[model samples]
Target: MPGCCLWGSAPPAPSGERKGAGWLELLLLLLLILSGWVLTQQPVGCPRVCECFVEEKTVKCANQNLTEVPPDLPRDVQNLFLTGNRLRDLSSGAFPSEPLLELRNLSLRGNQLEQVGAEAFARLPNLKQLDLSQSALLWVSPMAFGNASSPLEELRLSNSLYNYSVVAAIAELLQRGIFQNLKHLDLSSNGLVSLPPGIFSRLPSLQHLDLHNNSLVSLRDVSFGALHQLQRFDLGDNALKRLRNDTLAQLRGLPWLTRLDLGRNAWVCDCGIEDLARWLKESDQVEAKEALKCSEPEEKQNSSLVSLPISGLECLEPDDDQTQLQTSYVFLGIVLALIGAIFLLVLYLNRKGIKKWMYNIRDACRDHMEGYHYRYEINADPRLTHLSSNSDV
Candidate 1:
């Protein structure tokens, strides 16, 4: 009787309430299981060898000893770094069949890539920057970027082209107008002796050009004529002897140029180098002006180009004149020799005619001599003349 009053006791929970609580508990357990599974699993669509940052949309497969590109790259990965791998060649099918529509940066540095196929990067439509540094790139197809207009802006090929042929290949590739929008080009440490004329003519938008640590001996005035928008240029650590006045003038005319590097070169401080020395002393654009010392002429050796007086950078005018005169004499001698050779060749070609002419002259001379002898005899001996007249009668 003491516990019999159901109204006094708390009312029992409704079946609907119990059912709802059970359902909530079940949902929470399912959520917990899913979260655990997700925590244990790799990122969705990420390759096993690569680390993918989903939030940033970057995938790093560097130093993985990958023989080929990871096939399972995230569809939305914007920056893909495949550096320090063993990828020897980038064939047409190196990337996945599905194009990475958002990929912006690609790095293949430190690979053993010897060749780049024509369609190697055809799928990366929106790619902006490419770094192929430290690769043993021996050959690159002229159409390596495919037929579509490239949106590439920065191209880093430093220390990649091992030989002149490879450099020439890249030069040919550049002449094809594939990377017209390129803004920054790094060709440093490539041992380039000389660049093909008009190689950078198509890259009108080029701003930064790095040609340091090369074997370039000279540069043409048109070497950078197309780089009107160029801001920074590096020509350090080369075998350059002098920059002519016209070349210096062209460099001075760059409207946007802010930095110029001519240090560590084999600068010959002669009258020929006076223009460069004067420019270095006057302009604030040259970097490491102190390091641009005269590497030739024992007296001027190690002298800083900027500090050297323009008068000090002089050549013996008399000696130059004598040298020019000697050179002119040698040139004249060569021309005379060539003319003599040509005349001899012509005579040899008409030898038969010449011989006939000589024979005809000898015959005419002999005939004239005989007639003269006969006339003299007739004039000297009247008896001989009378005998000749009797024979005619």
Candidate 2:
């Protein structure tokens, strides 16, 4: 039993720890567990002025009041949360190391961030979701998201943007080949009156666009020219008094546009409203407002849409400019048609005169036909006929 305790029988399996051997084995098991846990909890050295901590495999830091940018975090953390922080400045090399950073989701929402550097976000190679909503971002670097290799799928900047310069900056970046992989973007509750032409010209992958609760007055034609992949567009809560026919018509060409929001607007439901209603009817999805309210007739504004387009009110033409342009197009078309008709008539008359001249020639030939035939007959007789016809002479 001493040397052969192989069963129950194994002497109860050495009831207590076997000193050195048992202690070493237990220590190795504990080390293995700790190692497994370490793979989840990455290194977070800074415990001052920031609440950066490792939660499972994520690095969550938020509600901090740091003035400047934070340091480079653990290279392995995929989800980094710095929401509700007071991060104001964003300089280059302020973000953590990337590719190795492996950041997929980054949340900087509810922060006092005002300026983000140009190359601040370009360093993240694996980033997919970025949340900068509810911040005081006065300006976003036009080239911030440009040439980004990361597959950033969603970007939130609504209710945080404070300036229209952001549009120009974004427009500049788009022109300069920025925002390549961006799919979703939000800029609602901002201050914007109008957008530049060809501003959103290259965002082919952008699907959802939020411009709700903004100060947009009019949506110029071709404003959304490049958003062929757009599925949802939020234009709710704006100061648009009317909708241009050309703008709505061009926007209706978006192949994937499924949802269009026009609520909470000062929509007069006038002729401009008619254009939008027409767009809604032609579009796949839309919702009309409850009713129309008149803007008073013969007002100071020299527009055709003085009275709003109530259900009883007729959908007359809104502004004179749009109608003038339409009239100009029509007049030009009519002029071209008349010119084409004149050309065709002139060609027909020339052909008729030529035919008459040919008729006179035919008459003249008839009169000389008998004399010519007699001369040819005598010349072609006898020896000529025999030589020419049979070579029998």
lDDT of 1 by residue, 1-393 (tens): 667676587768999999999999999999999999886656788999888887888899999999999998888999999999999989889999999999999999999689999899999999999999998898998878899889999999999997888887888888888787899999999888778877887888899999999988778534677788999999999988878777788788888998888888887777877787788887877877777788878888999888888885567233231355578899999999999999999999999999999999999999989777777777689677665532321
Q: lDDT tens string, model 2, 79-144? A: 778887778877666675444357798888888678877777877877889888888877777657
Best by lDDT: 1
lDDT of each: 0.86, 0.69
Candidate 2 residue pairs in clash (backbone atoms < 3 Å): 7-10, 146-178, 269-309
Off by over 4 Å in 1: 1-41, 312-393
Per the 3 Å backbone cut-off, how many clashing residue pairs does candidate 1 have? Answer: 0
All candidates: TM-score: 0.70, 0.61
Task: Pick the TM-score winner.
Answer: 1
